[model samples]
Target: MKPNLSLRVSQHLALTPQLQQSIRLLQLSTLELAQEVEQMLDENPFLELSSDDGAPEPDPQAPADATYSEATNADQISAGDENDVETPAVDTPDDWEGDGSMDAAVEDGEWGGDGTVRSGSGADEDEADAADLARSHESLTDYLHRQALSLRLSELDRAALRFLIESLNDDGYLEDTLESLAVGLAGADDAEQLDELVHRFTVALGLLQSLEPTGVGARDLAECLTLQLHAMNLHEEGDPAVVEAALRICRQPLDLLAKRDLRRLSQLCATGEEDTRQAMALIARLEPRPGRRFADVERNAIVPDVIVRKTGRGAQQSFSVQLNPDVMPRLRVHDIYASALRGGRGGEGHQALQARLQEARWFIKNIQQRFDTILRVSRAIVERQKNFFVHGELAMRPMVLREIADELGLHESTISRVTTAKYMATPQGTFELKYFFGSGLGTETGGNASSTAVRALIKQFVAAEDARKPLSDNQIAEMLKEQGIECARRTVAKYREALKIAPANLRKAL
Candidate 1:
């Protein structure tokens, strides 16, 4: 067989560096972006804070020029206008003025008296940045060691305490018993020493319980609440009656307290309804998680991708398709250093420096392109899912990457990258970009409903069910069928699980 060469024209998708960078930047959470920016700033000397670009100055001499300057920005300058063309100016306030020269204006402000250096002065105070709560809390072991320092315990005892602290879970509860702890510590120098260590640990246990969250370091709920009551008991030293009342409440069965049975609790405490109520109220106030108070709270600051506000026009809306600002690196190429390298004034490393300079520019450019791509994709999403904005998930039409890609005149994979990990803020709530896409479930009529809407409907049915006889998955499926949903019982169960809900048996009332 002869191998024949033929020319064919076809369409294909490619993953360019710019496209890859765009995808990476699009999905990054707010905190992730800040970290990325910091990394870029360190690697690329070219980048600087947007605020460091320069501060606004009052210039009476160029009032008209100031107005023009105000209008000029990164976005405006980048977009060309054929009819209204602009040339690089000789004298300007910027570090790299419009002049063709690569050399930056000196510290003398030869360009203008308003030469604001893009360094330390008035940088953008990383506003609307992701919450960095993870950094705030001290580790359990570190806290235990610090507490141990105040106690008059032996070195072996301190070590035992450290081990116990290490054994404590994230909720700050010690998981092992004294015997188990002793067994664990037996690997040390002496067995007798381990016994002594256990004794010291008992004292440390009290200290841990007393630390915070009132009830933390407790092995169980009963112990946890009891520990908190004990703390409150200690604070009521002057009032003997109050102290006695607290002790009685602690000694009683915890099931009564958990159920919030006030009348029975008053009788059990052997106090008046008011004092018992106060004690019950006090018990309620004590935190179950002593360590959780100190534990780092993972803060997920939701930034809405779309901002819809009511306007004078008939339901006017605007979508601010912003990249998580934190992720975009604040960069500006070092003109002075770059020029020196280009001019061959620098040594062998000049080549490397030039490469770094180019990389920095490329990164920034890619980032800008990523934001633009996200904006375009998000706008397309809003356009297609406009009904969702007016109504809600119930109104959300079935969408897929192909649909969006076709609309945007881009490849399906490009649409995928835009949607993946990216989120958009809507009037309903902030949702991942992918939330808009779902397979269509046909109704009895020609119309279709999203899987998300069906799940929501199922949730509503379950919420309104009789608690004594909770609606089973099969029952829910039947109900959906009645409503013309045509869903299977297993599908109902799957959606229930996805919603993090248990089966009807588990959800049943006592």
Candidate 2:
């Protein structure tokens, strides 16, 4: 049977190019969004950065409802205008007589002035400098090379040392064995040359270990600790008996030290219980990671997208939620260019330029929508978790993406996009927007307790636990049961691990 074509009418959802861009922009973190804006500014001639003086003054006659009151800065775009691309009106060429260039228009105040974004204030600059210090930090290799310059060594010894220095991992561990390293350096299968290279590497390794970072060039955690212990012994930094015990303990299996098996460690190290305890404590004080300080810390830096401030007092207490001005990119359509494109006579390139103008408008509109959606979602979170704002994470209530999505008349996916990489600066601390949402646990009162709150409670119990008798996961679960929250031992253990807390056996002190 052959199929025949028939007239049909069907309706299905579709994503326009502008809608796709909006969705893409919504999911980006503040840093990513800034980079995207910079790229668009470079690619599209119609787009430019709005200067501080370029922002339009608020009209005294305009109704209060027309502007967004939550924003501290007047340049903030209103969230209400979803359909309009609120661009400043461009003047016709007849209105101003000049060279007809963007520079001339900016000087005459016909469009945004200078198109130069101002640098952040002094406090912001200081914070930025601190952040830059993390990004521009000296690496472990560079640090070692700087110290190497002072060493009075033969050229061959220096070459060997440099080769060894380059072989170190980020943790300052020499993962490859001396044999393998020598084989790599020898670049030949000759036994005599391989043996000579191995000897050279051994000498270089000894010289490298004696460098200032103390434990650099270690092959394993045990070796790293032993090196630090030796350094401490040389400096007379600790008790002789304790240092010796610690050195002995480092030689034994590390699992015993990790489990805090005081009896086993004392037996192995041939030291008294008190001396073993002191040794373990001393081991804990030593730096296991020689390259930790030099590791790039810039990856951990966070730039929050929203700011929440506490307002009023007592019964009138409230919180003001606003988009972070610092993270918002000041962008606008190049008014003179747009006006010229509109006023010019028809030509082959005119349509392409018009398309670019429309793109710029759509970009501005999409950017506004992105921030607007974030603000709405953030406000919804602040409203629901107000108790958390006042009383900390322990007071956080159970929440889900659907709740905010329903409240804002947006899809759950949109809510997820808004929360994913976006951060909020609150009275408690800066938290990712998704941090406010967590699964719930049932309570005896027929209510739900947020998993976040449960984790916070578990953290509190652990903090206040007796050092001699730390609480176990089972005990913690029982305590939660007594508090009317039904949490199992495994759940408590999972939360404890998520908080990076050690287990009871490991936490126990002598």
What CA root-mean-square deviation does each model show from the true structure? 11.0, 8.5
Residue-level lDDT of model 1, residues 1-510, one tens digit each, is: 999999998755544444455556655655566688788877677554445345444223223432223234333323322112232232223432121111122221122212111211111366333356456657665776687678776676566566667778877788788767876757566878777767877876766666645666788766877776666567863355655565577778887766656678778777987677567656666666666655544444455443333223455543323333333344444545544555585667776775666566555544544555565677677778877877787778888888978765566766776677667765687788889998877788867778988988888898899988999989998898888878888889989999988788667643
- Say which candidate scores most in TM-score: 2
Candidate 2 versus truth, CA RMSD in Å, comes to 8.5
Name the regions of candidate 2 deviating beyond 4 angstroms.
1-3, 7-10, 56-139, 159-163, 177-200, 270-274, 343-348
The 0-to-1 C-alpha lDDT of every candidate, in the order given, reads 0.61, 0.78
Q: Put down candidate 2 lDDT per residue, 1-510, tens digits, no spaces.
A: 999999998755544465567678888988899899989999999888876664534323224443332232233332322222233222223433211111112111222211222222212334454367686889899999999999999898899999999999998999999999888877767999999888888999999999969899999999999999999989999899999999999999999888889999888878999999999999999999999988867767787887777878999888777666678777766767766766798887998887776677567656765766777678889889989999998899999988988776667888888899899888898899999999999999999999999999999999999999999999999999999999999999999999999999888887
Show the lowest summed lDDT stretch of 10 residues, model 1: 114-123
- State in Å the error of residue 153, model 2: 2.9
Clashes of each: 10, 0
TM for every model, in the order presented, reads 0.64, 0.81
